[model samples]
Target: MNYAIAYVVYNPTVEQIERINEISFGHPVYVYDNSETISELPYNKDIVLVRNGRNDGIAVGLNILLETASGDGRSHIITMDQDSLIDDHFIKKLISLAGVDDREIIVAPMHHTGDITYDKDLVGKSSQKLYVLTTMTSGNLLNVQFAIDVGKFEEKYFIDYVDHEFCLRANRKGYKVVISKDLKMEHSLGHSEQKFSLLSLEFVPTFHAPVRRIYMTRNRSDVWRKYFAIYPRWVLRDFMRFNKELLGIVVFEDNKLIKVYSIVAGFYLFIMNRWGKAELRYLVNGAKK
Candidate 1:
């Protein structure tokens, strides 16, 4: 069975990608470069670089790769972030564990080497029978068919919770998202930093994005709206729990506009039945200006 390692990048350091290529030598590297133009990627033939006309978000970029992987007849598509150090044995382990009939989405463990101390409870435990939710696309090996089936990461989400949303959808479809405790990788989280006013929100060593404060703020409501349509009370309870925590995080600590924008987005998501569309329109306007 063929497998491809795919990455989505925007104005990322060429050296870092090159280093990843060095680690995963002899495999086909598919990179969707969403920057202004596809800059020079590291390798030659094995590397396929798809350039978007402008800077699209990571979710859209990964969807491009998901399309490629599904069509190419590859059994597994390893989705990774540009700014991560993948384990040398990641591909080998995933390929070994992958069962065509098993219906599993694999997520590998990630360690943060930055300021936050490692917490076993947070990143260590699995949910129900499923794998623990760690970071994003960095350490994930997904069945290409599963991705294609679930519509390949909601582009409406743009970036934030795209992975979580994908995982949630996969679980709803009866696919078990499992984490391999053995495979180890380290991530330089929030490599995509944004400047809000003069004070830039420094990179947190996890999935935190200020610009994606829009996506993060809005898309979870999409999760609630869409998912709760099927499982009502349970998803509603979960939504309240998640939004309450998210409210504190954004309102108390984040940038004023981003915070207010999140509030507006989240409120509309709950009341207007728009879920994520309202925020998408807001982003479209922001992109225009």
Candidate 2:
């Protein structure tokens, strides 16, 4: 059976699309452009591009495609970033891992130029464990029914940890979320956190951007309140670990005020039902100092 690809492309230049078109063959591609306005796509009858009037974050953009294809039953939808280059065996592996469930969600493996590995050790035991299965929607595939059942990606996340949030939701619904160790696509690491590395590893330092720190810390609290209430220790442990890291200032820029603000704001948002945007501004001023 042919799987219709619901590919999300945001602010893609012509060159990026050409690279994507070259690699993606033997599938009906639905391209959703999340730019302020849509650009003219190069010819490909099988490819369909949709435009958003404004720049919605990746999570919201994906929700649009999910809503559009909710009932139409199109095998599985493969989420991707515009910069990703698909390996030749990509689709075949996806179909293979899809298994017997026509409504199954199959996630693709993403490879970067440097070392990148999913913490398989955390599979069933850690707070990181969403579900034990095949992939994550960050650049993974999803069954239509499963996607709809989870009510699609939460648009409230905007960006950052949205993938983690989706996986958490899928896990709650007993959907299997696994990592495909065999199939791999190349990804560019850290379009944002090039400067802040603690151990020379590619992962971003939590304190790289004051804005990102605010979002990450705040949204994570939201995740705990909404989903992990049963596992209260998880958030507490993470909070302690983060404080240690902040004191060390190992990987990220050492911004004590910003770090404290992140934690406090995250907590405040949880208890007060507010976003802590004002706190973010205050932290921004402190960061400037």
Candidate 3:
């Protein structure tokens, strides 16, 4: 199977992309830049850069990478984010776990932040378990043929639920989502981890920026509406997890009021069928006149 590396970079520096240089050997790489100002990459790399010239969101970038690479006769894509770092061994391990029948269309490495966690020693074992609810985009081997049949990604999702929505679609289509049992990767969630305690129990909430909160809330609403009938138990558990995060936000995070209001705005936007990038307000930013 011919494979290629597809990355979505936004406001990336050379140092960020430099991490992938080693593992990206032998396979072609498609870099979809969503930065307002594209940064120049180092010379002497087998990279094809496609600048979207604006922040079109992750889904759009992945869609472009998949289609562009598919046109180049690539059968599979190992999706990645500019910030996530993995070695050549990581890619080999993930691709080795693909189902013999190719029904496991989305094969991913296990991250601590995923639905389950494990010890470090389990970092390369493939389990027969399949069809997981979700997996992070980075370190995933997406079958290009399956993705094409699903009409690519849901670009209107912009960012959040892009991978999960696709995973759900794949499951519905008789394809499976597989994960390696012991292959561990440090995939982070939120801006940073915020730890707190309530009712004598400690909790850690994934703290996201206000803008991301809007996407999460809006797309999460859409996911529940669309998939609740098919995934009621998963929806209920996800609902509880979300509310718990909100409780942690109210108790421990900074900018709680603004983030909470962003959630409300996100829900309203969903009601209006508003999809794509959205701004909470013209708050302070790093813009220069």
The candidate scoring highest on TM-score is 3
Candidate lDDT (C-alpha), each: 0.62, 0.59, 0.75
Candidate 2 overall Cα lDDT vs. reference?
0.59
Per-prediction CA RMSD (Å): 6.2, 5.3, 4.0
Count backbone clashes in candidate 3.
3
**In candidate 2, which residue pairs clash?**
105-143, 133-178, 134-178, 134-179, 135-178, 198-251
- For model 3, what is the error of residue 204's alpha carbon versus the real structure, in angstroms, after optimal superposition? 1.8
Least well predicted 10-residue stretch by lDDT in candidate 1: 192-201
**Can you rank all candidates by TM-score, best first?**
3, 2, 1
lDDT of 1 by residue, 89-113 (tens): 6667766767734767654455444
The digit string of per-residue lDDT tens for model 2 on 52-122 reads 56656777778777766654556577777777656547766766777543333545464443433455313
- TM for every model, in the order presented, reads 0.71, 0.72, 0.89
Q: Rank the candidates by lDDT, best first.
A: 3, 1, 2
Local error of candidate 1 at residue 72 (angstroms): 2.3
| Model 3 C-alpha lDDT per residue in residues 119-170, reported as the tens digit of each score | 3212223355444766678989888988888778899989998887887777
